[model samples]
Target: MATWGPEVVAGAAHLDRPVRWLHVAEAADVGVMLTGGEMVLTTGLLLAGDEQAQVAYVESMQRADVAAVLLGLGRAFRTTPAAMRRAAERCGVPLIVLHRPAPFSRLTEEVHARLVHGRFAALNLSDRIRSSLTTLNLSGAPLQQLLDEIAAFAGCPAVVANLAHRVLATAGDRNSLSELMRDWDRVSRQVAELVRNDPVTVGPDGWIVAALEARGQRWGQLVLFGHPGSEESGRMLGQRAAEALAMNRLLGDRDRGWEEHAAESLLSDLAAGAARPEHLLTRVRAAGLPVNRRTFVPVVVREPAGRAGDKGDRSDKAADKEGLPQLLDRILAEEAVAGLVGSIGADGTAVLLSVPHDQDADAALERVAVLTHERLAARGRRAVVGAGFGCTVLDEVRRSFVEAVHVADAALAGPAATAVARLRDVRLRGLVRLLRDEPELQAFIERELGPLLENAPLLAVLRTYLKSGRNKSLAAQVHHVSRPALYRRLESIQALLDVDLDDWEQLTSLYVALLAHEAQQAVGPEAAW
Candidate 1:
């Protein structure tokens, strides 16, 4: 939108030869006028001094960017200096002198009108760009919407390419690009090489070729053919669009965080028995997670040693304390072992690890445990992990998880133990199964049998009877007590336990409780039932 085109010289008189448009200005400073690409316009008052100075001034104008000199002859010095005319001819600069009062007002009006037209053109282009961007945002569409809007504005076919130089989105006559995109399997090498080679302008087609790179990542290119717009302008707009798309992706990370939170909440409920694992699985599937028979690995995270001086309390803060369950979800999401892993336990203590197919599940569990531990460590906490044995069925997942927790608890009980133990490998398995957490039974035993066990003879007799499978003869033989003495010990034990010795279930319960107590006594306070 330059105001001074070559045709502006058409109206000016006293010009014998055709003068191409150069520039226009009235600055007294010749250097400023030249720098601004303006022709000099002034009366000959500059020639009022000596003739040599006049020749030097015209020579300076020749050396400078003054394309033409328009002198108003009616004002100031009324005549052109012969030295100035000789310098102009020598420098090949067009020189004209106006005798009558020149039409300065008309020339100013023309320049002003052209300047206004240029501003209007720029304003119009900006409005078009804003409208296109607004339409793209309003549609809430993907790449195609932006391309179509921009293409329509430029009156051309537009194409979006990915990092592989394959077209991701396209508008207008797409046959040229479609062949390359849809046939990517066949043309991947060619496309990769082509983009890497350089930006290529398709020949004779008026198409501009440019690359699409964002955030230091090369996303590919966008091409527009037969577009009636400046190539630089179009590239600038497209780059802005690319940046907006990347920003949208970044903004979506929050939504992903919320999803992880909801999934973790669901997992905690299932582990706590408030909800079933199947319920969580249902929701997972509904959310487009392909989880069918994922094995459950129940981990127990705890505080690390440095948290406080007291090492006895190894329990970490609750899983929900700092969105820990959600943290775990993000950690496991990118793992190869856990395709669609999530926590599904009460207290957010259990995780259901989904392994695609029957791969080496043990390795996967180890990886999951390592990652979980690392994450916990990073969070200024420590985790004690226990993975359940692999199960092919979902119904059995809950049971396996329960067993994993039990194993982990047992391992934690031993002061020397640092790692989780397999449920089958824990030496106290029998004792753990036998010990019941019924406070009523414990109270009855402590109240009634406390005095009997204090007496050595009565304790020996009771032990003999319990080990002999409730046989009186076997009790007497083992304890070296007479039949009558054995009868007396039986009566004492019956009174102590406050249960029928005749009933098999009661006798078995008492026997197991006694054995558990002995094991508990061996392990001390740390051995929990």
Candidate 2:
């Protein structure tokens, strides 16, 4: 109390150390009876004339890591002892002395009550945060909502970043977050290094980080930027927020694997239209995909038919399939393309390239295509890559992805000899593939090719003839038959169908029917109506 005229006599620099508790000890060797962080109060009754004991006392206090030593003036020397003060200063332990008589009991009672109250308040705050986050989690709140809540509690920006130091989501004031992100590339690297080296929960500059982990696998980190609170409380908030996120992820995708990479999750959501465009844009930006004045190119790569199991061994096929995403990622990185690459359906990989407005989008796509084909070919796999129209608006990115998927299907169905296939390249075949599910298309396929449906030999000859663009000579060579024999087969087919083979309009109809039939067959027999 001010009435007691308390003054710091030594080690004033260490006054900021936390006081875990208060202790009253008069024994010369009282350090053994106490734990660390206790502020010791004494009258110095035993060490009145012993310098060696005084020095030993301060050394023992230092060893025990006591918070400070407070000496009452009356019973001890009238003023602070030179030996003890020097020793305290030397030990860098706080030493506060009462300039007048002060009651130790009252001082302890007051400080202890305040300490208890503070601890109680902290517990309440912790419980409140935990309950709020738990409720949010149960209600199926989105990841951004959870991050926003955490940011509100922390009074600062919050960031969720993958292991690669890419931000996956962020929350808090836009201006403040923008300031933080302006130098995120450097800050994130430094923070990642610090975390790796020390693994401390509370980092430099009031940054509190908690690892998002489950079952001993860590996928990302939750960071609270510059929390304006005691380190203990900041760490509590961070750990609680991290737990909520991890639980949210676990409950969000329980059936599938929880270790889905961050890029894949974002791309998948974008393609599926499962999340709002604004939300997806936020995620895209946070995921480190360029958004401003950028061109978005959506591409899909499909594995050749029968290539998955071509190795014959199930494990080999599984390994190959798993490496597809990684393979695409490597190519993207090596080519210096800013993109999100991930697996789509069973045999397709999707990539969203963010090209700067100043860069040529076509050139970027061509570079990616060349490397992709070259790398996949090196692995004894030739994949078909289909790219959609490049767009500048983020809202239209999902449409691009859908279009890319269509182009990929068309490429698979038609004769695509290029490294990269676009919508125009697929031409009539692409149109048929896009509308292959139409009832009219199915009916037309049946009406035009119904006569040859059951006759395997004649159907093969007709398909070969149509595919050769009415070239009877090439059709005969392909079927390994004489021209006369091919003519006879064609005439027999014409007689069954009761249609003239030489009619231009009739030939065009048959060609479209073949395209539709092939497209439907590519999807499988179950899709046929």
Candidate 3:
């Protein structure tokens, strides 16, 4: 911005592009003579009367990628040119009018000086942020201290969220942080995939998010609740924060932080009422998880199957597991659900999300689960989100969590369970799972399918036929065999088990036996009832 007034005549939105150079040119084809980012000044020497010529001049400027085009007035027909204004706006090149008969030399000098000063100031700021963060790192400051400094630089609430937008660490005033995080699931979903080292504003609130990445993989995000300054500053602040977080991540095991450990411990204890209600609230609040005050929806995410023995598959699974926490957090934030996510079991994540009371719980959970599956699929990972009960009371949360676990376990049992199942949908399988170790159930399974169990192929054929409800074509298709081949296997199964294939009552008994068998396989033989 030069001291000499250069009022914007059109395309003011583009003023955010910082002017890097200024050029005084009256030639219509001056864009060909300069590099990009130069705010070209013209007196319409060749564009005074011709509208086409003026439009062409603007087009050339656009091609050269100039920040803005200034049209000097008085000599160029007394007033600003309509052709030039429309051209600049149409081409998205800012049009600035020099209202007064100003000297070009002074304007050029002023703009150059300002640009230089701004660059140096930005450099100084980067240095300061780096210095402070480096000092903190060298002194072994906790992660929160680094985040606090970032929040200070941004001048707003700041948070660290796993890829799923689950808040990991936060800084700034508690009230303000709460306000910023409220309905964060929907808010965070508006975020775009951030380019490395580039910060982008997200949502209508102008919140800024930058990737916290290392070794070519992004683990989570650093967020400014509301960036208070120019995009340049936001980018700088985000980059600095990203650097600090990445460095800290390299220096420490972020997943094993005290905060994460504390959350896991708290959630684990909460599942079984290890503490009193009032004390639990205090602990939840201290851990930054909203509880007792909002409608909570418990969810569990787990891989669809156990890892294969292939090295490639194992590596991919490991990567997905490592990324799962971040992914869940990001989803909740994007869904605008006020949620808390933590590690649970060996390869699963758990979330306690707060949704609006009036929100459709089934739709919300389905969408959350669907989107989670979709996003994870984009990274070549298959995951399922099982939903539990939704409740307002803190005491009810434990039951909801337990239900979520049951639903997740059911989904893990087979492909038919779908990626997202509600507690109501999985109750039967859950019950069967719980009773898998009962001697009666074991005896029943043995009586029904014991003779056929010795042959794996025959057992598979029988299970598939039962799964299809004796639909010969579907079972044959599933088994990748012809109808005759499937019938031969069915006859063998019938001969071996001495069961009637056409009897619905016999089919029911066998189905129950198969369920018991699968339940044992799913939980593993060593698993206790």
Give the top-scoring candidate (lDDT): 2
Q: How would you order the candidates by TM-score, starting with the best?
A: 2, 3, 1
- Residue 99 in model 2: lDDT: 86
lDDT of the structure predicted as candidate 1: 0.54
In order of lDDT, best first, we have 2, 3, 1
lDDT of 1 by residue, 187-288 (tens): 545434434344443322445555655466655566665656554455445454455444433443434432344345445444444545534433444223
Winner by TM-score between candidate 3 and candidate 2? 2
Higher-scoring candidate on lDDT, 2 or 3? 2
Evaluate residue 517 in candidate 2 and report its C-alpha lDDT on the 0 to 100 scale. 84
Off by over 4 Å in 1: 1-262, 274-281, 287-289, 292-323, 339-348, 374-381, 415-419, 429-435, 438-529
Q: Which scores higher on lDDT, 1 or 3?
A: 3
lDDT of 2 at 326: 81
Score each candidate by Cα lDDT. 0.54, 0.82, 0.74
Query: Which segments of candidate 2 are over 4 A away from where they belong?
Result: 49-52, 131-145, 196-199, 245-282, 290-293, 298-338, 341-351, 356-529
lDDT of 2 by residue, 1-529 (tens): 6899989989999989999999999999899988899999999999988899999999999999999999988875887899999999999999999888888899899999999999998999999999999999999887767888999999988988878887878887776676667678887887776675222388777888888886668888888888999998988898788888888887686643333455676777665656556555656767778878999998888876564424556677668767888888888888898998877767888889999999999898889888988877766667778988899998787777777877888776553788889989989888887788799999998899897888879988888888787899999999999999999999998998777899988988888887788778765211121
Output the lDDT of residue 49, model 2: 88
lDDT of 3 at 468: 79
